[model samples]
Target: MSGFQIGKDIISYVALGDSFTEGLDDPHPDGGNLPQGRYRGWADRFAEHLAGHVGELRYANLAVRGKLLRQIFTEQLPRAVELRPDLVTLCAGGNDILRPGSDPDTLAEAFEAGVDRLRGAGADVVVFTGFDTGFQPVMKHLRGKVATYNMHLRAIADRHGCSVVDLWSMKVLQDRRAWSADRLHLSSEGHRRLALRVCEVLGVPVEGDWSEPWPQVPPLPWREARQEDLQWARQHLVPWIHRRLTGRSSGDGIRPKRPDLEPLG
Candidate 1:
């Protein structure tokens, strides 16, 4: 399946990544038994659009929330290989950055390991989704972290003969209207925007209308605070609360600095 030409034959794609790839905080459209946890991320949108353009193209999503690069290389990559995918999309590394006190070198190594393993497994087209650090306030320090990882990713993709999708350059994160309220995850509209990016990168015709209302954003199933939950409340919500108290946006109030990100390569 890996060597199958995409234009000549219908392709089979497998998506492997973390929460964004898994559609975390997005509602299931069908609302079936497991509907609340259905695939609603960019990968799903990419598959839907790719299906309409190609014949008999099938997709399998294997993205999990909070997945580290080590786990992806050690576990997910092999399983994805077993499926023998013609096209593969990967959107990992957020968890690695979000982890406590993570260094660039460590994250870079883990990321490269996954890419090496996947390329060795015969994936024809390998797409790496870039990081979107603009979504979270706390991610300010981790902006360069993505570039560090992507540099290695691009190098590996070139050496191994694969393609890459630079999500970081899309600037979707800078548009607050495109993001969810918490400023951590992508809204349904955001997912659609992401689907378009994937289609353009892969040279596949987009399937559905990009203007449609997307699947609703779902609630987090697990308990615990994300970096955004903490920083968003601190920067935005706290200032709003102070405004309500003092009835003044003119006066000095709590202000948090946005994280600095490296320029897109």
Candidate 2:
């Protein structure tokens, strides 16, 4: 791992996906305010891990809630292209599968289109992610949907010459402790594991657990905040706080700053 030079070569990374990629269940220090929507997912950990590997690289996450294959192509992918990212990681299709009318054919087409658009925009390496069907309620119900989506995703990525992270079959998914109460989003420890794996996929070196040690500080004003409420804060509040903290606008995890589409752009 030390022999690898990813630290010297890589710079920007843009993550595009659904709720899991957004880090829905992960807790936040600011009363769960950072994720704005599921903002604390692996993408956030990936960025922090990258900071350790590389210095001064831009990390952007454009993952959204309930986003489908088509939405990513029309919306998220375009914005990502504008960043001119060096590496692009996508973890979509979970929400598409959970949709009432979701069908494999429609999803396959959308994934293909999104991949093509990203390649056209000159992303050097695109890392794709698969669903963890066995770990969640909705995914368990649609287990078959995961295979169908991955089949298409793998085929498209192969044709385009890109890499993928098969989270569905990864051992991490088997651990109950890896997920949050929702059984979909990752817990803090889960996020740490995810960061290590994603670094391996990107051919980057990983060190440490990458988990944010729970601060000894007092808890948030509220006793509790669920995933849905956390998601709301992710899209609305986190960016505001990031701007305040750094005097620059950005989301905590993979989500990026696009003032052009502020107010949930």
Candidate 3:
């Protein structure tokens, strides 16, 4: 797609959603006191791109890891509206979809509501479809559910005049290197590519292509694969299950790293 020209008047940008938008697993050594990681995702990268094109830019990221769609709508959406940014990127619903018995239709209804609200506030809204996880051995089962949610997201974006970054269609992400060890979050290179992809959708100029291929690697042995599965279950899956059972979230007491729309330094 060709880059669309953004008006010079557009300045403030706010990002809302969960870990994906929060830039998880893409560590920043100087994350300060933020509960999780630092703010360095596609949102921040987009803001930097905007700043380069338009001079000064104000940006805020209200995303936190482990936030469900409902929580994001109830908590972040209101604040985003209050901020009245010129641009808002919303990438929620993944957390909800991963949960057992979550309904895509129901989730879409809530998601569309937030998009409508952001549009009503006169901000350009951007939404993301969930990635296809069929290649992941443990996450393959959720492919159907993710597909359902992605379908809903596209319809919602169309209805609300919001732009969408179609993650499910990005074949490059099928590479195992695109994902972190937990198979939940994106790796640093993955985040870089994701940023470029978002910029492409937004008609922003980017330095590189997100679809660039990675170096080839040999497949792991069967025994190694099995061992890795056991390790993953022990290190990530079990903890996630525990958190769910105890009614806890990774973002329990975390606050937004950038709560206000200010100059990006």
Q: After superposition, how far is residue 23 of candidate 3 from its true place, in Å?
A: 0.6
Winning model by TM-score = 3
The alpha-carbon lDDT assigned to residue 62 of candidate 3 equals 94
Candidate ranking under TM-score, highest first, comes to: 3, 1, 2
Which 10 consecutive residues of model 2 have the lowest summed lDDT? 256-265
TM-scores of all models? 0.72, 0.71, 0.94
Tens-place lDDT digits, model 3, residues 1-265: 2113466755788999998888887876466754544757667777777777775688999998999999999889999999998888889999988899999989988888888888888888888899888888777899999999899888888777788899998999888788888989998788888888988888777699999888889999999988988998999999999999999999998888888988887
Q: Clashes in model 3: which pairs?
A: none
Error of 2 at 184 (Å): 2.4
> Which ten-residue region of model 3 has the weakest summed lDDT?
1-10
- Please identify which of the two predictions, 1 or 2, would achieve the higher lDDT against the true structure: 2
Give candidate 2 regions above 4 Å deviation: 1-10, 29-38, 135-138, 208-265
Cα error, residue 5 of model 1, in Å, equals: 4.3
Preferred candidate (TM-score higher): 1 or 3: 3
lDDT of 1 by residue, 1-265 (tens): 1243547455677777766777754555754755334547676767677777666776777666556667656656777787776667776776666555777677666666766676667777555645657555656667777777778777766766777777677664466556766566677777877788767766776655544453566655444446646767887677755754674532122111101111111
As a whole number from 0 to 100, the lDDT of residue 195 in candidate 3 is 87
Candidate 2 residues 1-265, lDDT tens each? 1122355644677777766676666654454544343346677777777766665567776776556667666778888888777677776766556556778777777777777777777775455556556655434878777787788877877887777777766764566567665555678778777777778777767775433344355544553535555774676556544655574422223333221221111
lDDT for model 2: 0.64
Clashing pairs in model 1? 25-218, 26-218, 140-259
